[model samples]
Target chain A: MKPFTQHSGIAAALLVDNIDTDQIIPSREMKRVSKLGLGEGLFAGWRYVYDGAERAGENAEFVLNDPVFRNATILLGGANFGCGSSREHAVWALADFGIRAVIASSFGRIFRNNCARNGLLAVELAAEHVDRIAAQGAEPVDIDLEACRLTLGDGTTIDFDVPPADRDMLIRGLDYIDFALRYADDIDAFVTRDRRSRPWAHLRASES
Target chain B: MARTLFDKIWDRHVVRQLDDQSLLVYVDRVFLHERTGSVALTALEEEGRRVRNPQHVFATMDHILDTFPGRGDRTLVPGGEAFVKTMRRTANDVGIRLFDIHDGRHGITHLISAEQGITVPGLVVACPDSHTCTLGALGAIGWGIGTSDCEHVLATETLRAVKPGQLRVTFDGALGPGVTAKDMIVHLIARYTAAGARGFAMEYAGPAVEALDMDARFTLCNMAVEFSAFTGLIAPDATTLEYVRGRPYAPQGPDFEQAERNWSELRSDDDAEFDLEYRIDCSDIQPTVTWGTSPEHAVGIDGRVPDPETAGDHDAGRAMQLALDYMGLEPGQPLKTLPIDGAFIGSCTNARLSDLRAAAGILRGRRVARGVRAICTPGSQVVKQTAEAEGIDEVFLAAGFEWREPGCSLCFNAGGEGFAPEERVISSTNRNFRGRQGPRVRTHLASPAMVAAAAVSGAIADSREFAETGTNGQDAA
Candidate 1:
């Protein structure tokens, strides 16, 4: 994971509600066992036009495909963005496509967690603030994880909310497993107590 | 202080508080499937981590596996073989149990977890699939996670997480005949919107919920994620206990009695308070179906397509218009008698033995209408064998529906087999997202019996009509 302290880049607005993971990267495009090379498949359903199963050409109508926003690194989205599927490939695809942060009114719970783990900043702002940011069009926006602020090209600043733990993880690129492992003794103690209380819940090798 | 069922389970699993908002919660079970399991396991191996409790971890080869008879490693989805091979090898190397394709226990991860009794009351279950919430129907705390979380659970058996707010959705009154659990959930999503339960854990309660059987409860809880809930669950009752007793992974004899005693205590206190509450009258629910891409675009079978002009606000109206364009539907068009090209009855949402029985009841002595391609894939090998023993497969076959092998077939086009492009399909699957079935394909989510009704009529028709008057004017029962 790459640490994300601050980033300044063009922001493309896709203001459609319920932009699910399937639209981010369709199940058909996730044909590989590894996570690499997913950028090419990001929004394949909308980014490219298919002529009978083959990618014939790009769909110029899509916001990200528009020439002016071709290099966007921040995404402005509608409410409940990334609303379906727990597939992390959706986040990976966005990161691979050069998106460093996403500003939305809300997000799917699991998708937000995936973004935290992967160092992709997911900032939840008011819907009006998101609309204001999207109104900036092909202008560059600034995201400061440490300050919890987004600055538009016109110098208008908007505050956003990222959970404290998620902000810490993104800023430091911390592996959550490392943090959880620090409390190994605590986990062991709980397991021991739980085993004594609910033996049926713990499955032994033979019983399993 | 009275505590809700979620608080009870969550507090019991807490190892330590990481922050004011987050805790290190112990996970009791971890289930995985080939599609995402291989990636997680491979990452763990690369990181030189071993599964802390391999015995509690289970894997299956359901996702991306072909559902055709005599299916093997080869799949229509390009590069799908690598996922299957890697999952088998990695799970074996990790020393965790793997329900490979030939294994009688092989099935969709969520169904197999309950079928094998891996998900019991008050346990914390984690999986890489969103439908992992389906296990919550058994009184467990189950939620979907990303691959990184999977690796974390495998390495430490604990997750660092924030406790979500609780929402109690009570369905009172008795559900009318032919109105199944699937309808109850779809109605909730449509009324409340897809993101209604965001950042909250939901509990299904009240009289109507208690009246549902264990299988029906599973159907109700399966779409919790569609409502954008962290997870959803029901209190353990006699139905849940009877379903778990004597399962392969359930406790035996005296241990079972002890387990039952504990499960009996797994309900919300009488004075428990939730962050939010919704009380719905079950009588108001009808056999619901999605008319557009998102599950939120659903309406009762007798309802008409919503016109974008009246769809509220500018953004909402634009989204509706786009959905209508993609689905090729008119604003005022009625959902009934809308012709369809295909019908599917499979996926974790409604592919259990009871689901198969419900569909077969409608298909017996009836044939699919001409030009309609119908197919049925059981949820698991166990479901398939059990349905065959009950002679339900013959009903589907005689109705011109293809009775295929058990797997998550045609659910999301991951298997490379789906309705043709631009084809409209009435399916029992949970999602109706754009191109979810195939390129440019349109899907409408419904119950198993509803899908059967559509297949017979070659159009979107009410299953209750058939339920009231038998398919051939004789008693369907």
Candidate 2:
């Protein structure tokens, strides 16, 4: 859950989309404020269930039960990777599930911000690059945030390019809006200057 | 350029403009929730800063309230009753208005604001909740903020902000039979892929939008967030005025006349400027269902799962794979072939009385699918009580669906009675994001009647079958 520029770990691909907060960590499993193991709930439904319409036995026949990606890291995900309510649990669960970074084609705005603000390396790659990394079949891949590259097995390194702003925010471990607001002093001074220059520009506050 | 209502409102509200796209825009009305208010109040306390104006702030307790009765004395739920208690105390402690459960006004923050008439035309409102955009249906520009932003707004009645590009979605063709505003917007989301509306304020206009009733308009604007829009808006029209009249918060008598006169002109002028524009043929839109985790992964009810081989775009192939894994559907599979385990007919998006009435109308003589659990929750205490009084609850009860109290209920899974891991639910709530209803609870977002129809047929029923029965308002318009 640390947001440092230099950290590398095993990559366990979630390889799914729409991993909502509730599924990321069910409300029942989220009482303690402590950042505990949320990986178990990452795909609890798919990894452990099978029945007529409903998954049988919390641990039944399901795709996640395949037992290969049990502790994999670096999830290779689908588009709109996290869409729904603005709950941060989805990021927490993914990070806890041993995913150091997520390589997705695109990420939900809120989910992406939540991940960065809370310290999750969301790697946005073009679809073909993601497909190549995902095509590496159950093998571990390496992600280097500093070098902005993801290395798969077979000694192949696929470099990733991120926007400088996002890269700075990630490397510095700062929230985008939070970082912007930290300059409130300068912002306030500029506002005062602008108001002085254009008196008619000033407007009243919303009604009392 | 002539100022839009937004410009007029913004001009009146710009306390100042700061650098980095942050303007000290004045907040006309501020709505507070338990979590954000705690942060706001805590900051003011740490700084020993007293509020400049408490009367302008309104607080509600819906954020963490318990929606399920069986969750063990309600005390078992996390911060359930305490949030309610804290909201009241926080409001009182900070000299703000509080809407508690017993006040008969406890519900979604946006619902309370609109119903209270505290949200009005040409106002800039901000809450710590996203659905705050719901008020835009009334022509006010309501935006959601973070807790820190909430602190700023509460302390100074102003928020740093940036104006957004505007997009217009005009629609032609009368709505097809069985098409709800929910369907139309889902079609919009499916077509635009959620982020298409990014960096813009969406203005929903045209014959299709104008034809929509107020409740439908609210449903359309309420979901503007799902499409990545900063805010969704509709100009205040006669329909908007009519919906506002006689509400507890709307003006009365002489004041009402002035308000109506002002509201009548809230539409965009013929030469009004917009950065982008699009159109939708409402009649071409159909009952939609999502096949993947994202709201954008949707197809018309009659549509089938997309085959990745034919998917020309690389992202499309990944979407196809994701749909296959998450939704458990094969390529080219029909959505209706899949079975549904539960049905939900409530959420801030579609739980109004009119929404309930439509669900009731569709379920009048039909029984829910055997082994399928269906629950219908009203958006507010008033809606629940009134629906029962009007026998709408009787219709749901007769159909064997659980009639629950007012709250987010199964939609948010906060009630603890949400989707079992791996269970599929057909819901009328917005957004089908993974695990939204419950853990592993694959959710299919649909209109109320579509949910009811699914409940009746035990699967995705051809809405046309029931829609053909002449039961709903399909033919009336």
Candidate 3:
């Protein structure tokens, strides 16, 4: 579980908000249990043709159809980005699309966390700021996780403040599991104490 | 500053306060879905442990498995089969009950929770999936959790957490013609800038909530996640109790009568604390549709896209740009003119019987677009059976749309049966994120009826045209 902040090779930008789990890789793509390469199917319709035109045309109507943004690294999106069902597929799709960071005005908490834990950055920007980045399409909006700044093509750098906890996550590239894993010793001690104090979990553990 | 149900529930859920800034909250139930649940189960295995309270955790196969086109897991699409298999094995290994693909009780998480009374008010519920907030419609504190979070909760039955401030969105007056809770919420998301419910537990209140039926109330709470709310809820009113009556796990008979008395006391006091409050008149809302990639990038069905020239700021300019490119709409163009390639009616959000009826009424005599792939999928298995029995399925099929089985079909992208990339789809499910369906499959969520209208016209069309097809759109109101 690599943290989203560590990855810089992939930059993802999406047009829609509230991207639910059903939409990410779709239930069809989850046939295998392993976390394999789901990137090819990332934004499948948009990256491909509109109803089978082969490669997306330059004048194609959809964002994924735009030629200039063929390999966009960062995703600039509208408000309530990643809204809807809690599907890690939404995050998987982004990460698979080579989109390491998704700079949006807002994110659905569940989808955003899945991205962070899966090494996909769900960077937050003010709606106003996100609008600017979206306007700069295919021009690459640099997200400096350390500095918490979103730099535009015109050299306009917008400061983004990362929450301390999330910042720690990015800096160390630790998802919640990895973050908790850091306190494995402490957790072990607590588990030992808790087992003795309550025994419900351990008792249940023994029986099940 | 009127108190909403969310603040009331949040205050009561607080248990021991730790020295560190976290709250040691108590969880009543934990729902484990297949995708992330498998990981959580494996982690527990690595730790040599079990679910803290197996009785409190419920497992279901909703996301990964394909139940669409009907029951046989073997017949399920490849992806759906794999998801179900992974989920089934994980749940069995953990001694958790699994609602495998064919189970009559199988469906979206929220619907199952309600049907089973697992979402009784005044309890804390967490699931690995986002729409878990749909249970919040019952006044429970519900939100989505990650696999590790699920793992922690499994071992400890509690997790370190911060509480959310409450946002009370009070809509007074009755909803008008063609507007259901889905439309009202979509309109609000469009108006409130999508992030309006951020950092808050959105409580739907006032005359609007009280007037809404159980299904409508569920629709409101279901989308709270759309606006970044931890969850949303309405107080357990007579309507709530009525909906839960006789549910499998609901308090029965005398127990139920007594439970109602307790439930009635769950409302917040008039002076309850709240972080924010917004008021709207129900009459002011209209049929809403997205002209761009984001849900917030929406306007009334008749409204035009926001002109970049008129965009208020630099950020607004960017939003306009992406919306224009992704939705294939020019700035200031009327979204109503944009064509659609498909229309889907299903998902946890709007896949109920009422949604189907509404959509069916509109499609009865209409012809689906020539090349559009239109389908109507019920949210639950029960809904499918009921709609079919009522001839609603016929209405849709007659309109040239596919009347699929119970599972979530185009609602999300689960079965991989969605429109081609850049092919616009009018969906009844929540969320329309980029590549949400079939990679570049573009989605516009509306009431089932609205999607039905789009299916007929092959573009974003209003459901009003179908008011006379089956029944009056305003008659329900």
Q: After superposition, how far is residue A32 of candidate 1 from its true place, in Å?
A: 1.5
Segments in model 2 whose C-alpha atoms lie over 4 Å from true places: A1-78, A88-107, A112-208, B2-12, B34-53, B68-85, B251-265, B467-477
DockQ for each of the predicted structures, in order?
Answer: 0.81, 0.15, 0.25
Instruction: Order the candidates by DockQ, highest first.
Output: 1, 3, 2
| Full-model lDDT for every candidate | 0.89, 0.69, 0.68
Query: Highest DockQ: which candidate?
Result: 1
- At residue B427, candidate 1 shows an lDDT of 96
* Residues B1-477, model 3: lDDT tens digits: 555566555554445554344455656678877667876787678768667667677877665455456456544355445556666777877677666667777777777778777668766788887777788778778877766567777876666566767788888898777778887787887777666888577778888778777777778888877777888887887777777887765656655666666677778778876788888888887777776666677777888878766766545566567657776777667878578778788888888777777777777777888988877767777777777888888878888877766665665556545567678888888777766665566677777778888888888887775664321122342
TM-score of chain A of 1: 0.97
Which residue window of length 10 is worst by lDDT in model 2 chain B?
B468-477
- Top-down lDDT ranking: 1, 2, 3
What is the alpha-carbon interface RMSD for each candidate? Answer: 1.0, 6.5, 5.9
Off by over 4 Å in 3: A1-31, A36-85, A89-107, A111-208, B1-4, B18-20, B67-71, B74-80, B253-258, B337-339, B365-372, B457-459, B468-477
DockQ value for model 3: 0.25
How many residue pairs clash per model?
0, 10, 28
Identify the candidate with maximal lDDT.
1
A164: Cα error in model 2, Å = 9.8
